[model samples]
Target: MNPITLEGPRLTFRELREDDVDALFEIYGSEVATEHLSFDPRPLDSVASVIASGIADTQVDPRTVYALAVTLKEDPGLIGYARLALEAHRAGQIGFALNPSVWGQGYGTETVRLLLQLGFDQLGLHRIWGARSPKNAASARAMSGNGMVEEARIRDHVFTHGAWRDSITHVILEDEWRQPER
Candidate 1:
């Protein structure tokens, strides 16, 4: 696949590079940002290792992952990341995290919309899904804002932070997404 760069009104999405390790580490290394995530806060070395592997994927498998860095368009500073993980079927699963500094500024909703557009419109995917910890109300609203419907509450779905956590999944079919009126 060609290198895909998605442009939103205020952000740009592209493959993360080795040089982005610092910014990525800043997001992942923070306890506040990573609290609801499956993985714990990572060290700088671990982040560098992951970035090295991700950047080596010359042929990106949309079925596996399209991990992208979410950066501000004007300043080009990395705020966080958004991922579209494709399932065995045609549906794709989306997720994102933002810098704690930018939490309530509508970036989350815009990020979801951009990923949905990339998955459904550019990738020709039929369905796109997202899941968030039941405790994450902000993520719930962001997914809903993008036309995703609550699908299920998967109890004990994932073991994180030494305990089983519940996850609520949301989905939007291609036919259900209403493109913005220009």
Candidate 2:
């Protein structure tokens, strides 16, 4: 599949490259930035590994995951990244992160909407889902903004930052997504 370029008012999404390793490491290495992610702050040794893994995963499982870089079209700075990953039974999961400086400006919502379109329209996915810790109000809002409905709250589903946090699952089905408003 060709790389995707998703645009919004303030951000653009494009496929990541090997050259992005340094920038990715800068953002992903920070404890504050990586706080809510499934993985902990990335290790120095894993920088190359991460980039390679993303590329390899996309090639080996095009239907499973596509990792993309998020940047400002004007300045072209690598601010963050996003991923659309196919889950079991043809469902998809969306995840992303942006530089702390860009939070609250609506980039996350826009990027996610584009991924949902790609998942449902282009990839023929049956459903798309997202999950986050309850404390991450901003993430929850972003997911809801893209038409995802709260499906369930998996209590103590994950251990992070020395605590067991509930994972709130949100999903939008293909039929539900076809509504006029969406």
Q: Which candidate achieves the best lDDT against the true structure? A: 1
For residue 73, what is the lDDT in candidate 2? 82
- Per-candidate TM-score against the hidden true structure: 0.92, 0.90
Q: What is candidate 2's lDDT per residue for 43-82, written digit by digit as tens?
A: 7668667778777776674447788888988866678888
Q: Could you give candidate 1's per-residue lDDT for residues 1-182 as a string of tens digits?
A: 65768999988998878788889888888898888887788899998876776566536543367888898887676798888878866889998999999889999999999999899888888899988899988999999988899999998988877899989999999888755641
Candidate lDDT values, in order: 0.85, 0.82
Off by over 4 Å in 1: 61-63, 178-182
Q: Which pairs clash in the backbone of model 1?
A: none
The numbered model that scores best in TM-score is 1
Worst 10 residues of 2 by lDDT: 55-64
